[model samples]
Target: MKKTILILLLHSSLSWAQMQPFPLQEVKLTAGVFKNAQEVDLKYMLALNPDKLLAPYLIDSDLPLKAERYGNWESSGLDGHIGGHYLSALAMMYASTGNPEMKSRLEYMVSELARCQAKNGNGYVGGIPNGKVFWERIHKGDIDGSTFGLNNTWVPLYNIHKLFAGLRDAYQIAGNQEAKNILIGLGDWFLELIKPLSNEQVQQVLRTEHGGMNEVFADLYIITNESKYLAAAQRLSHQSILKPLLAKEDKLTGLHANTQIPKVIGFEKIAKLTNNADWSGAAQYFWQNVTQTRSVAFGGNSFREHFNPIDDFNKMLVSNQGPETCNSFNMLRLSMALFLDKNDVSYLDFYERTLYNHILSSQHPEKGGFVYFTPIRPNHYRVYSQPETSMWCCVGSGLENHTKYGELIYSHTHNDVFVNLFIPSELNWQEKGIQIIQNTNFPYINTTELVMKLPKNQSFSLNIRYPKWAESAKVTVNGKIQKINKKPSEYISLDRKWRNGDKISIEFGMKTRLEYLPDGSNWAAFVRGPIVLAAKTSTEDLRGLFADDSRMGHETKGKLFPINKAYALVDESGNYLSKLKPIDNLNFTLDSLHLQPFFDLHDARYQMYFQTFTKEEYEKQKDIQKQTEEALMALEARTVDKINCGEQQPEVDHNYIGEQSNSGYDEEQFWRNTRSFISYQLLNKDQRGTYIEISSLDDFKTENLEITINGISIEVFSNNSKTIRLKLPKAEQISLKIRVMSNYTTPRFTEIRIISNE
Candidate 1:
């Protein structure tokens, strides 16, 4: 029966003529950086207590508790999210390495979840806090959602989507039949829950970050050959996001980056399964815009969790938030889906770049902690999560990022094999009766050799990618060079009969180049092949290197170093590459700095981007930058507590709650406005702050708004000024509220700061 089910899945998967990635069980990671990362991730996964992760599910099901729920995000509104990610990581790791511990843990988790579902009595199982009540509200059409919350709960749909994805991965990747049953049960529950809602109401619910609901439902349809699951997938795909992409419009600016990327992945999945050309085109357009116009050299996008203006990346360069790990995690997923669907080698370029630079560098090599942010602001550091304390969204994605490095190393069709990345690995293509051993020390060594071991002579094509960054790529068979000229972003196919001892080798030359920001800014990053290079600047003042359980512990809270103090390339000859002297194949020396692969640099402040200028422009630019940095530092010294109004993490950290409120970005600043009321609770830190300041992007009429402190009305000192300052009460914690006096919406508040008079 198991073999029959596998055959059926394979038949259904080939309904579309797309490249398919080999199962993780077939591609084994050899000795390399990726293998080391996998081992480290496994250790971190073992460090987490399963009972703590399962506590919320048990509590929701009214089962006897074995352990307390984990703190941080687990105890916070987003309870049980990491447990879902843990399920995926365990399944993939078990498939990749066949580790007995991983399989045992996976089976344990699935069984416990099965128990939870049975106890719920409605085929429902989730770790979301008060999930029963939350879904009931949605079932009754009592929907209210923002960018990160739904029905007064913190992204309960997104939280539950993780479980759905986990169960799907468990069944599909690890061959757990029980997990599949649970997934279908949950899917049916969701289908019935939204049966009474209108299309408009579903779209309203999609406003929150719900992960890839459409993609999971589509997987369910593929698994069961059911029509309802397909319809549910279509209904869950947010039309507001899809319409703009379908029309080839980039309405992505100012939107949350990670939330939209997963939806596009779902778009590609549905397009492939149903053969929808328009949706396929929309997904392609989105991938092009994000990769070509919005991404940094490291292949990560966004600033402060929102997509910044494509024409200007200055805000991203200056802010400590930089590109988030979750954005890159989802981008890689979208890239892989598009690459398989279109057989495009260009998509592999981004997948390889992000895998090497961002994903590989996100985890600590020895400490086994996961990074939330990879800051590009020169001299700024990143904070990694502790297994027991940290539970951020990035932590959830980071846990799975390193466990699946073997996913896209190679892809294939019926009679052809495609080498997508240069990572060292061994592939056993069971259906094709072939085994290939790929050996390389890639990025450090510029050549990879593959040896074929087959039962007999086989006639098939071996397609190897010619990377966009590799110059003068060469392919050789059994030490004999083959003349096949191809440009970058294309594949060179070797079509012939292959024997047991046949060998194929690929060699390429890498040249260092200065890649400027996508915004065409003066700032530049160093890249050689697909590897991003950086220099460690300082070891001092690396505060919060390992995160605690605090709400904002994932962010680097150290003092910001002045931008003018960072190293720059000031050359009058318009030749910046001349400054870099090669120390070795993967290391370089630039004046007093030693640069190496970004994945190798850790535990210190580093600079990935450096400002470039001519000799004549350096001094003047330095002075301007110094003044701006000084003013920003002074404000930090005066601020007791502050919140960026429309940003997701900041608002969520401050316990934001509102009704009839909306948030957006304008003039490169985030703002929130409301017709009803919006409130946030901020800390004053020992009653040192005497004044509360509210700043808006637009002028506001004082007569049309009511400002309150702790439910007490406060007088605004400025009538129509962009800045409003009011006296604060003598309390350490202040509840700030802004409401419209009549029917008019309040001004777009950009920031709220607690000020100290001293």
Candidate 2:
């Protein structure tokens, strides 16, 4: 009877999906690198104070506060965002490990949030600052939105989406009934809130970043089997993004990378629930485009949180900010959805690469802190978040990344079991009266063994994945090798599986190879099987290794080693792998440096990519590269403050306010143009800057423009040049404004830099 009830619950939770992952409670991690990561993440999660995370929800709901809100992002404009993520992390960890403390924390959070909902009396509860007022204005159809702000609030929809996701996880994964009730109430409130607004208004609101709102509503539909929730999910989908995707256009360049990935995940989810092949095809096209053209060898995409042009990764190669952790966090979700819905082994290949290279490398092994960015620039470092002082989006996602490593290790149907990842784990199939223990030290050693325990002889197929990176594989049952006929990216199935203590072993060999950048660039990365190989360069200047509670603390604000000075591979023949000498199975020696798996090399400056050139080409280009690097470094050194005009985070950080304004990307630059006015607050600390330089993608010679410094008119030094300089006012803080003087719109401004004349 107990097993029957459990099966019923599992069926109820996964009625809509074509393929289903086993419940977290039924899978357990054994002694391995991934298991260690899970333990480390649990420690980090416990270090965060639950009371502080709940402060925003309490204060906003007019309830008594138990603790002050944490600083950094939690107290800043994006208040209470991490609190939602914490609930999810807690619930997933509880389900994955069956830890009592995690369950207690999850229950506490759900109950507190329930109180907040009850106090609001309108079924609305959130951690967004002044959320009540913000929703009231949104409900009244007074909407003003930009790329990262709606009604002058920083991604309120994105912030609230975290809460919605957290509540769903609590109810579905942890079996918390109260959470389901609270989720229904919040979903109803959201439905009513948008009922009065037109579809156009909803689209305008969606211009800002909102994390997977449509996906959560679809999940609500699955939970309640209600048509209204399904309708809401369809209504909430962004038409602007959907239209271009359905047309199979690559309109993703220069867009925020993490923002779009979650929405695409929602697209796949809704597609499955409604059986819409068009939508599913669109999502699949997006996945192929991003994974094949835009991504680095490490399986992470974008630079500085935005998708760079696929043909040129030069900007990403030079910038200190590289692939963000949040992008990988969402991409993995999309990959899992597609892999399950399509039953494609190709998706699993990408998933395994990213899981080993990017996701596992994102967290500190011993420090128990989360990383926000994993810069690919040679010799550059990353900054980790301190539990008390950091609340970045990556931190929120990072909390969940390591906790659920057991999610895709094994999946099953009623009569078949699929072995997906090679991580050491055990699966309990209670309904079938079977237990499978999988043990491996993969990548370290290239073999995995599975021991099956069954009460009676049973006949079922065991499908083992054949990764694309492996050239050949051999499978042995008991003691004899079985005939192999499957190719790469196809499953090798054993037809008969039975009896207790039945053992199966799979062995494969990995070879070192070079993977060039997707843009066909000269830069190349070393890969062995699915693991990316990196070399530690130096540990001279790893500034802000651990973050403090500052707005940009998540970024590594350290001296950038000159790109020209970085180590390069120079050879006349195109045999880069010949340069690598094997020290062991996983370690190699290249010249004077030692290379190992990227996930194991931490707390030091490392190089994941190397510029490759022929001997003659290297001799000829070295001098020119040095000159360019010097000039770029000099410009960076002289800057006191800077802002990329049209990007989301940069503009929001500068307190941007505009009327009759719009932004776009053109000719490899992001720009903003205004017919009325656009203003920003910039800092010239210690009054060190002598001039402010404004750059535009388009020439400003034909337009009438009025520029002001702290509300005072300033003379532009040049009107014909693409860049104009103005004398800086003698103030620490300057309010700079650009106004259109004629009927024509202003030039497309790309960047504003406060230059020091010292």
Candidate 3:
């Protein structure tokens, strides 16, 4: 008996269900695809030395450290971040697995963090480098911030939000009462610190990435039932980002992908709690645009950590850095929030697809390593993060990803249960006195069986999801066929009295199909019942298969195969997906190439999108591809190091600094220049380069340009030549600082490369 309520939501009248999910503790994953992933993740978590993870927090508290800090991002400015992520992972694992060891770990982490907060006295705990000084400046209304920096500090607010989220998870998921107190105190401290800031100043500070600060504040309100926390959440929402989103415009191109997803998640969370339908609609619009236009076939978005233009996938196809793992992690969260509000199976469909392909495939099957990017570039590989050596953001999210599969497998209300994913797991409905066990091999085997254990005869509803990819499906009760016609992407609901020992079986018709890019490109991905399939290319030159502690360790710095060499499907008369011949067990073969589930087709170069062309198209494209590759290869052969301007990590790693300068995306290209000046430190390591090659947009706004290498000015021509090469004066050190300047406006410089003397 459900009643509907109408809400005026963002240019539409909508009605939604009051559906909510069962607690994570109530859902237990016992066996199958998720369990294996969980075990691997647990082993990796235990392998990490907790003392090292806690070092930064201890240091910030003016306390003695137990161990040296972990390297990479951990030892760098963004310390203590992995520690925060670790706490959440432990809490989720404890709740899902009933693992006493995980519970103990959670307790230990919370206690340590609590001690730090107690020492601070004002209830602040963090590992951001010189975080106290930065916040003090902010408290004094002396804020100087940018998209990635605050008062010359690296994302201090973002770093602290990790602590906020961890503490919240510790209390909400693991029931750590002490964690709740610390979290609330910290929240209060934040309120006091920002009480003096004007809304404009707050927005200025929020120019940097602050991961889900608003969402965590709303969660605090939920836990404490305090209106002040909700108000605080509203104050924390960045208006600049939210304003465009609320207006239902797409201003997301060129923005950092993961940085924006969390903010929108906060918007949706606040909307649900306060019934702010406009904000909810904004979040919905963002999700639709990203998943539909920006995202690739694996349900992941972004290239090289930034959103490439929707109309062009050239950057996505050429770069070894593709859709990041952390972006998909947050997208799943956004999807879950929307699904609960409207009870939409489409959201669940996306959740299932991304979970299976991206999140499930993020970790190595045997090594227990985590992947940063799943490159769609043909013949390009991926780098995996080792437990001790890598502390990249993806590693932090990867630790939590596998531990929480039980979260969306099954959800329930007071009288109805919804089995969302066909993973083998169990649900403990303690309130209703029922225990249910689901057993299935899932995508490999199209059948699933559910058995119920009840103390007595019970009346409730069982809603099983019928995925959008299923061609046909059937259900039976205790071996008796229950004839019910249901369409794709709808739920098959059975409402009746059920006694103990009742059994239910479901069988789905699995079929293969082709998914194309949103831009209507010739490239296409193969999908069999929502599982993305890939063909193994060659394993040669799989450099950096496992990441090191270097600044750029997460990237796969191997040679990119020329696009002209890619295998093409020449069949123009029919659909290539249907033409594939089936092999054994979710495996297929097309034109001598064997394809298997992407999650299983790792450890080697693989192709997710096979180039398909008609006879005429193939002939025309082949020569053009070869010509372009030859020119690109010629430039690459003599390059010692290169930087792509306006990209975050590359610029930061190269020590970029500027004033009166701006960067943006235009015509599918990212460029950086300045009204005053902009600069970067280009490495000429091994003394290999005597020339600095700068490529800019053909359009120039200024007649005269000033350029310098290592503080020495060089004469430059003010012409329309897109590529300019300047000879480097003799230098002993391997690094040189290069600056480009204009009195009024500078040309849009795209790439800066240090070329070899040869």
Better of 1 and 3 by TM-score: 1
Report per-prediction Cα RMSD to one decimal. 3.1, 3.3, 3.0
Please state the error at residue 144 of candidate 2 in Å.
Answer: 1.8
lDDT of 1 by residue, 514-555 (tens): 999988889999999899999999988888999999988999
The residue pairs found clashing in candidate 1 are none
Clashing pairs in 3: none
lDDT string, candidate 2, 328-446, tens digits: 99999999999877878789999999999999999998887888888899999989888889999999999999988988888776577889999899999888777899989998999
TM-scores for all candidates: the values are 0.97, 0.96, 0.95
Specify the poorest-scoring 10-residue window by lDDT in model 3.
7-16
Tens-place lDDT per residue, model 3, 369-437, is 999989998888888999889999899999999989988888876578888999888888888888899
| Per-candidate count of clashing residue pairs (backbone under 3 Å) | 0, 0, 0
Off by over 4 Å in 2: 1-18, 701-706, 741-744
lDDT of 3 at 402: 91
Sorting all predicted structures by lDDT, with the top scorer first, yields 1, 2, 3
Q: List ranges where model 3 is wrong by over 4 Å.
A: 1-17, 675-677, 698-723, 729-745
TM-score of 1: 0.97
